[model samples]
Target: MRFISRTSSDGVTEQLFILGEIPGVLWTPEDAAGARPLILMGHGGGQHKKAPGIVARARRFVTEGGFAVVAVDAPNHGDRPKTEEFAEVVARLRAGMAAGEDVAPHLATMHTFLAGHAVPEWQAVLTAVQELDVVGAGPVGYFGMSMGCGLGVPFVAAEPRVRAAVLGLLGVDGLAEAAARVTVPVRFLLQWDDDKVPRAQGLALFDALGSADKTLHANPGDHGEIPEFETGSSLRFFARHLG
Candidate 1:
């Protein structure tokens, strides 16, 4: 890993780190040292690691929640170069929809392709971050939604270091199998009127979680309209579980 930039504010320091092709930011509290609890944040589709929401949450996790935070660009998102296959998938899906054809098959194909890479990419980021030694062997947690949740389900299931997770804004179809393997404490968020994801599907995903300690926070809104209060609730959840 190599340093790209460093900035500090309000007793917290945020640094950009690049690991070969993967680029991400790390947030550490002032005077922090060895083995602090870490939170791995995942961004939504079309959002980057440094997106405002991600940065804000990272800052909160480091400064207020007293944890180190890291977020990497998912495949085809953020600063990473887009794959031709992903672009083609999007074009095909759009063309199919415009032609009044059912796009469920296309959607499934795309989800499978993305999920295949997303899980391993997250594992790579986690491995890289752990090697940095800034965050010790403390408990690890995850926070993600939408495409993040789509990928996070499998990642949390496969990564034993993640002790808890906050996932939501997703459907259940492609992720249920992974969700069934996630035994970590989870706090799931659901937008009641989500247009991109059906409420029933979101509930099904929540129900599929193997976590004995999981809580659902359902609110009235569309996919992008998650209330600030829900974010606060998630912060508390992480603090309770990971802190």
Candidate 2:
């Protein structure tokens, strides 16, 4: 990983870096040293690694939990160029949404395509990030919702480095098999009124997790309307598992 630039503010330091083809950012306490737990965050669809929500959560994790956090731009998003195959899939997805078709299948296709590449990319990023002195080979956690959860389920399932995860806003369409393999502690968040993913499907996904230690947090809201208190809850979850 090659760092491009770094800036510090509010007792946190942000570093932008390029890991091969992946563009990512890392957040840590200012002047931090030695090995500390790391949290890898995956942004929702159509969002970049530095999206406002990801940054806010990263900062809070660094300041409150004293953890290092990293987020990477998924393929075809942010600074990465879209492959022709990915573009075609996205075009179909947009067309389906425009025609008011049920987008679950389209979203499933998109997530499948993205996860094929994202899982290995996350593995590589984890390997590289952990080599840094400021972020060592300590326990790791993952945080992703919606598209992030779609991609993260498979990645976390395949990666043994991850000790815990905050995942939800996705259903069991194309991810049930992977969900069944994730043995890490999981805090699954579901929106009771989510129109994007049905409540039954969300509950089914939660049911599919193989972890003996899993909790479901359901609130009345749309897909993007997760309650703010959940963020604090996630911090405590990671602190409890990773520390």
Model 1 / residue 234 / CA error / Å: 1.0
TM agreement with the true structure for every prediction: 0.93, 0.98
Give the Cα RMSD of candidate 2.
Answer: 0.8
lDDT of prediction 1: 0.85
Weakest 10 consecutive residues, lDDT, candidate 2? 100-109
Per residue, candidate 2 scores C-alpha lDDT tens digits across 29-100 of 999989999999999999999999999999999999999999999989999998999999999999999999
CA lDDT of every candidate: 0.85, 0.96
Residue-level lDDT tens digits of model 1 in 13-68: 88898877878888999777777888999988778998999988788777777889
Candidate 2 regions with alpha-carbon error over 4 angstroms: none
Most lDDT-accurate candidate: 2
Best by TM-score: 2
Candidate 2, residue 218: how far the Cα is off, in Å: 0.6
Any idea how many clashes model 1 has?
1
How many residue pairs clash (N, CA or C atoms closer than 3 angstroms) in each of the candidate models, in the order given?
1, 0
What clash count does candidate 2 reach?
0
